[model samples]
Target: MITYSTVKSTLIEKGTRILKVLQFGAKTADECAPFGDDSNPIANMTAIYAETSTVDEQVIIGYINTKQLAAPGEKRLYSLKNDKSISFYVWLRNNGILELGGDDHNLVRFEPLNQGIAAANGEINTELQKIQTAIIGLGGAYTAGHISTDIDAAKINEIKCL
Candidate 1:
């Protein structure tokens, strides 16, 4: 029989990682034609360009629970960030938290925080009663979003878990 305090401790112990974009959409060109092919008109078409970006890891904080689990209820809380704005939903499982929405019963009860804020107060108590069982750390993973390239304009300042 696991308790809320126990689950909360596990999530805090595991902590979270933030992903930052080191380089956004950098481009590079590759030459497909060989020296001998340079004289051919087709050689002009051999140049190809591709765009890519680099990312780094940072730290974030958040919370978790089993109110949304389908069977043996489980829950988790995570705080991670990337170069983009993201939205997260609860994931409940018999074992551990994982991608949002599967056999587990998803609760659309939670809402996003206001601008520049990562968490809000008093929201957990309202949903805590809905949980049924202790979550085992087997299949849990946080469901996150990539706010699109255009919106990822600045570096992440902070991530607070409540």
Candidate 2:
């Protein structure tokens, strides 16, 4: 979810240009601006504005390119292609808008997902649940207190769900 803080920051920094969340559907890739001698990326500009909790303007200010221009700590620009509709969270930069990471929130940003450990825990939880259920079915002494431990419970509960 987009948070109020994100909107506030964008407004403070961009002054006139505001952040917008947009959805583009069934698009085709075309040649766009070249980054260097070898990298020529494709882009699409057709999009429909998505409503935000904080901002209500429906107009899209600028075109969004498919190429991802990496900032500091990034390796290189990776161009994106759109055939089906996709949502973009963007802000104005260099006379055009650059796509921010795909956080569809219009008010507050959600914490990033930690898939590495979560995946392992989810797998363990699934197995634990199966074993617990089987023991109870066989009239064993397994009870609710024997449920999965914290190692198995610390998966996706804290992350906001769409």
Candidate 3:
């Protein structure tokens, strides 16, 4: 059996050029890595890897399963700011969640339709109105009354950096 690490090692040689962006057969992909079939070693394998040598930033994204892929399950990227300390995993048998340990915090699951989050958003609108009023109070002279209220991107003619 070709181990996942072994496959990656074979494809990417040490002291070779680092990949800038890579995306697997996509359900989703990021701006850094666009989705494509990059001549997968295995007939139906799907995987991607991207790296920026300047800041040593790297991202790994994948989607492989029984029908679409031969090796392992898909993986979302997890990258840190440090170089020579990055790690990648490709051995998830079934669909699962990826967890990270940081600041002694516990795992958090999110629901897009959660009611609590919805309720909080209601209050956010009223608070935003107050912020708009405050910015207008600054007495800046412009055709637009206030930046917060006049948020039409096309109407924005001039911008000044302070």
User: Which scores greater on TM-score, model 1 or model 2?
Assistant: 2
lDDT of 1 by residue, 54-96 (tens): 2321121111221232454655323223321223444555565
Better of 1 and 3 by lDDT: 3
Worst 10 residues of 1 by lDDT: 1-10
Which candidate wins on TM-score?
2
Against the true structure, candidate 2 has what lDDT?
0.39
TM-score per candidate, chains pooled:
0.13, 0.20, 0.19
lDDT of 2 at 114: 44
* Backbone clashes in model 3, listed as residue pairs: none
lDDT of 2 by residue, 1-162 (tens): 211111111222332333322233221112222344332212333332333354533333223444455454444334344442333334434544343554354432233334444666678777877877999899986543322334343445555434
Stronger candidate by TM-score (1 vs 3): 3
Give the per-residue Cα lDDT of candidate 3 at 74.
55
Tell me the RMSD of model 1 versus the true structure: 28.1
Best lDDT among the predictions, by candidate number: 2
What 10-residue stretch in candidate 2 is worst by lDDT?
Answer: 2-11
